[model samples]
Structures are given as structure tokens and as C-alpha cells.
Target chain A: MNDRTTVSPSARTTIRRLPELANHDRAMLYSIVDEAYVCHIAFAANQDTHCIPTAHWRKDDYLYIHGSNGSRLIKALSAGAQASVAVTLLDGLVLAKSAFSHSMNYRSTVVYGQFEVVQDSAEKLAALDVFMDKIAAGRNHEARPGNSKEINATSVLRISLAEAAVKVSDSLPSDKDEDLDLAVWTGILPLKTTRGMPIHAESGEHIAVPDYVKNWAD
Target chain B: MNDRTTVSPSARTTIRRLPELANHDRAMLYSIVDEAYVCHIAFAANQDTHCIPTAHWRKDDYLYIHGSNGSRLIKALSAGAQASVAVTLLDGLVLAKSAFSHSMNYRSTVVYGQFEVVQDSAEKLAALDVFMDKIAAGRNHEARPGNSKEINATSVLRISLAEAAVKVSDSLPSDKDEDLDLAVWTGILPLKTTRGMPIHAESGEHIAVPDYVKNWAD
Candidate 1:
């Protein structure tokens, strides 16, 4: 159902400043969510707003998040609190000729909606499997699945990706005509999220390293 | 000063779940903020809550952020809207024997406060220099400084780090005794933000590369 490509679904979602950086493609929104392992969710409760980071994954047109049943985030979100979720990937630092022109290259997406509690047990289990698969492909089949009690104590919630905005700034540094002629080094110092060598747990030393672990750093 | 080591200075900042993972060290809180380039801010405006990502820099015990004077974030925060800011660094994924035990190793901090606008022109310029130093040391002196008109069009704001909560999860993956005996490879796939090669802007190719850009990826 991601064929819908229009963005800025509402007044608040519209990008008022630097509107050129706004991306209208649905795939752009999906890619931003898929690439990020964590997202910050903003919601209000008890006259205070909170921005909390948590693991997230996406399936179809819904972005899913799970938390302990007793968590304040879960308690407020499940009670129909409006939520704003943001995922950002910093790509590089753009060094412009002028201090005011210096900027960062990043890809970010924001979703605005009310999170719906995923009440169906079967759907919840499927969503959890999707999350596990994201962490490590084929991991759901290898690991022991969550028990009934464990499932009951966790709350799964999803927000529709229909109302979202994506912004991407990946271009090279730009400077004013006068500043460009100045003797200054200008370019992009790229930044990337890369995987490092795996660290095996002591208890799993006897087990063979899976393909996911082997290819992690590659 | 940062000598105050107490964390969770307010009731809402308390970590109720997995309280053992809560950190009380002020140094830990400062490190978390210092290491991150961006943070998500939660604020209410026009009856809608927003989670926005922006660049941040820490000076003394305050976290500073800047934007154009016309931006909504600058307008809302400068007017004394309450804010909840969160910075998170994901270290790795903890793959355990059981799906339910899977977790992530991360250091996260949340600060609750109202931002105070930087009114003094000299103070604002000094803060911007501090931000430049974080991006690339010695580059502030090399680049063309912001002129009076440019400085007048920007707004800088800072929030105190006094009321904050720090949560750190950096440990080997653990599983239930019964699940630990299963033939599964469990460990951490570490994630790191690394710098890549610098790409020179076409207009600045004649300029010599500075020491910062030369050693960026090193």
C-alpha cells in the first residue's frame, strides 16, 4: 500500500523553511525508516512532553514500536495520545566558505499521528518476528520465540505512515559568490554508520558464527 | 558546575523500568551529549506536538542550538515553550539466545527544561564559534565570519543540563538459563559512526586542504 507518494499530508507536516529540501516520494520516507534502528517519539502526558528513543521497525505502511507494558511511553501512547516520531541519519558535515553557510548533510523523516495499540495476539507476534528479522535476518527461526507471558507483558503499537515528511540534504557545500573566491577549503567530510567486528558472548563460544555475523562488517 | 553527580533531578525524569540501567554520573551525561551531533526536541505548538532533529553542541552545563529567526522551532522555544530533548548513541545490537532477550547497547540522555534565548550579540558569536570548533577545530578562524546582518537573522538558545536522566546499556547479551544452552551464536554487532573521505568542492580545488580535512578520516 506504499504506492501513495504525496507528502505533507497536513498543514503541520509541510516544510515552511527551505522547502526545496522536502521530499515527496513515499519510498524516501520508507527508506529513512528502514535504515534507522532507533527513533525518537514525542508525546505529551501529565502536562509534560517527552522525547524518548526506542527501537523501531516497519512493515507495509505502518511503523511499529514495542515497549514494556509499564513504560510511561506505552501508557500514554496507548491511551490515544498524539505522537510525533522522527528518524534522522547524519550523512556528512558540509564545510562552506562562510560560517553562516555551513550545514550538515542528513536524511530525516517525521511521522505525525496517534499510535494504535496492536491488540491482536497473532498480529503482534508477526510484528515481533519482523523486528527480529530486522536485527538479524533469519534470526526469528534460530532463536527461541517469546513465551506467552513475555508476549502478554509487552505492548506493540503502530502508526500509519500516511502522514509523513522526508527531508534530504546530500548536496555539496555552496557558498556566496564573494565568499567562494576567498582562500578557504570547502567540501563535505562524509559520515557513515558502519559495523565493526562482532563480539561473541562467552556462553556462545562453542556455537558456529552465523552468516549474519560473518558478513556484518563487510 | 558539572561536579553535581546526581541524575533524575525531577520526578518525571525518573527511570522506572530497568532502574538498574540508570546512570547517576554527571560525566556520563556530559559524554552522551558531547558525542552526539544531533538531538530530537519535543515541544508543543499550535496544539500539536513536534519531534524535530537539529544540530547541538554543549558548553559548560548547557546544550545550545541555533536556527534562523523565522523558523518555527526558534520562535516556539524563544517564547518559553517547555522542551524535552533527547540524545542517543547506539553502540551495538545484543543478539541473545531468545528473541525476548534481544536488546541494544546504547547511551541515552533526556533533558527537561525551558530554553533561554541568547540576547547578547557577543555571546551569540562566541557560541557559534564553539559549534564550529566541534565540527572542525581551527576552521572557525579560517572561514569568513558571520556579518552583522547574518548574525541578526539567527537565534541561539540554550537549555540547562541540571534536570536530566541518563540510561546506559553496554553489556554482553544475556539469556535465560534454559535458553542459553541452545546452539545459537549470541553476541554484539557493533555500530559506529565513522568519517569517510572528503570531497573537495569544485570552486575550492585551488585552495589547499586544511589539516582538519586531511585528518578527517584518520
Candidate 2:
């Protein structure tokens, strides 16, 4: 099922000339999403499209995203439906003489499908657990479970793996022969995003950070 | 033009509250876009949608984004068609006890509308100037004008400001009263993306860095 046709069977996708990477590169796709602690979610709403930048986690072939009940995204897809989600990481910058040739090094993935709220009490509980573990494994069991009100007020969405693909670009741009001597500085500005020290809340609070929190990345 | 309407606007779309960032707070939108140099461009194609991460620069109300003439995006939105473009900057990470509460701080702008390639030679030249100025202020004048082939091969899209908004979140997760004693870290992990030194390429030749390059960022 994880074939090029299964994901983007359209002529619109142009991954043919790009070597070292393919549209169906599962490892690359997973790595980009896994390395990122957040994803940008976009969808069409009111004939106008809306893009929401949100934190998300992936488990197996599905994505588990949630937010407070008041969030528009929660309400949009929670009412028995689905939408689209995308995650990406900028690897580096591509500088060239021609402004039009400037590009970026990055790995990105897009998943399109329907998403619905986790309904069955057990499944919903499991989904919630998966999300918790996905973020910080053992921490799921260490922290206080959401009170009934908190559970009821928040919404969790489960979007099964739909059509998706990974696109990666890591090339330093190529400049024309004559234009190459323009004397302009034109090289990459490498970029990396990583999680920093986990600061404790200011308020008087006390709890041990589970080992899972220490190992969690991506 | 930007107002809230609660209705299933289209079959593929349902209104969602994505931070309500566009509600009269328009200047915040421009500032966020200006600070970000890269954006993830997404669109609905085939049976599923796709998101392509690329570099982008803005001028006034319009954003000029381009790629290889063979790019999937260039093919999809050629000559006066609409598309969705988004730029985001991840500022920090939000750590909370509950895995579900884990989040990030970011500023992102999502814009939707039509785009048309600068088909006219004069228009393409103007866009090329804008492109250079956006990256290196006054370098476009010093560089040679793009010929027909160079101009013809690349696709330059002009996105209107009709539908767009900036959604931001910088809050530390709400540390609960009881969970306060849990002792787990619950604060932010700051992030910063900066421009690095530029790399210039010549015919196995090294040319002195021009004032244009030296003062590029100055």
C-alpha cells in the first residue's frame, strides 16, 4: 500500500529528476515528522483556506492531534469528519545569484484524509495514552490523569494514514557560468530546530521528570 | 473581508477557530511574515492535498515565491490561479507534565487566494527586481537582467492578500494546582533561526566579496 501511486498518482507531483529521494521515501517522511515536535495544519474553510500551526505527535501509521475544546480545528474535524495535516523541517538555505533560484533545504510530509474524535471510551483512552507516550513514554503513567472535566473539555483526533509522501531538498543551488562571478556571497545558512532544557513551572511544584521525558525527541 | 461565519462553507471545509489571530490584529500578521524567510506552501491536488516547503519573500501586500519550472507547485498554479502559502517561525517549546499539554510557541501566517505567473516580460523583470531587493536590498540593479530563457523557465507567483491570518501561541502550559507538586519541568525551550555567512561560487575561481555582499545584511 505504500507505493507512489497510492500516495500521489497524479502528474502534478515532480519527483522524477530528484535523485537520492523519492516521493515514497517512508524513512525520510517519518524522520521529518518525528524530528519535528510540531506541524502546520491547513484546510479549506468558508471557501477560504485556513492554516493553523500546531504541536502534534505520530504513532505507527496514524497521527494523534488534540487541543482544547474551544479550538476551531477541534470543532472542525471532531464533528464526524477529517481534514489535512502537514509537518516539515528546514535543513538548510540555498543561496544563488538569481533571486528566483534561492531555495531552502528541507524535508516535508503531507497527509490528506478524514479525522474523527476518538469515541469508544476504551479506544479514546488508548488514543490519549498513545499521545501521551508519543510525547514522553513513561510520563503517561507518571502524571495525573485528566480529570473528567478536563477529558470532556479537550478533544483528541485520530487520522488514519491516508495518502502521503516525503519531499526532501538538500542541494546547494547551481548558478549560471557567467553569473557565478558576481562577487555576491551565496552559500547555505544551515538551520536546525531542537528542544532545549525543560524548565519547571515557577509556581511551587514538585514532581520527578520521568526518564521518558529525558529521552523524548522529535 | 475577514469576518467570522459559522457554517459548513464547502464540502471539504468547515469553519474552525484557528487562534482567531486575524480578528482585527492585522499588523501582527505583516510583522510575522517579514521575520520569516521560509514558508510551507500547501494545496489540494489529486485526491489528497500536498504541502511543499520553500523560500519566500514579501513586498507590500504581495508575496513572491518561485521554484523550478518543472516544480509540482509551478505546474499546478501557473498563470493566474490561486494557491495557499504559509510562513512560520518556531520560537520555543512548551513543556508540561501532561503529554497532551506539550506544545510550542510560534508565529505563522496562512494566506489563500489566486496566483499568476509574471507572463509579461516587463512584469517578470519587475518581480525579479523585487525578489533581489527582498533578499539583498539593492543588488538587483548591479546584477545583469535575466534573459528570456531564464525568465521563461522559472515560475513566479503573486499571491493576493485577500484571505490570510497570523496565528500565534506563546503561553506556558497551565500548571495545575495539584500537579504543581508533580515537579516535572513546565516552561519554554527557546529557539532562534539566524542568517549565517554567505557562500559565493565562481569558475573554480574566488572573487573578492563585493560591498553588495558585505553590506547585504548591514
In candidate 1, list every pair of residues with a backbone clash.
none
DockQ winner: 1
Each prediction's Cα lDDT score? 0.92, 0.63
TM-score of chain B of each: 0.96, 0.78
Q: How many clashes (backbone N, Cα, C below 3 Å) per candidate?
A: 0, 14
**Please, what are the lDDT tens digits per residue for candidate 1 over residues A122-210?**
99999999999899999888899999999999999999988888899999988989887888898899999999999988643578888
Q: What's each prediction's TM-score? A: 0.97, 0.77
DockQ of 2: 0.32
Give the per-residue lDDT of model 2 (tens digit) for B164-192.
65567767776656666665656665666
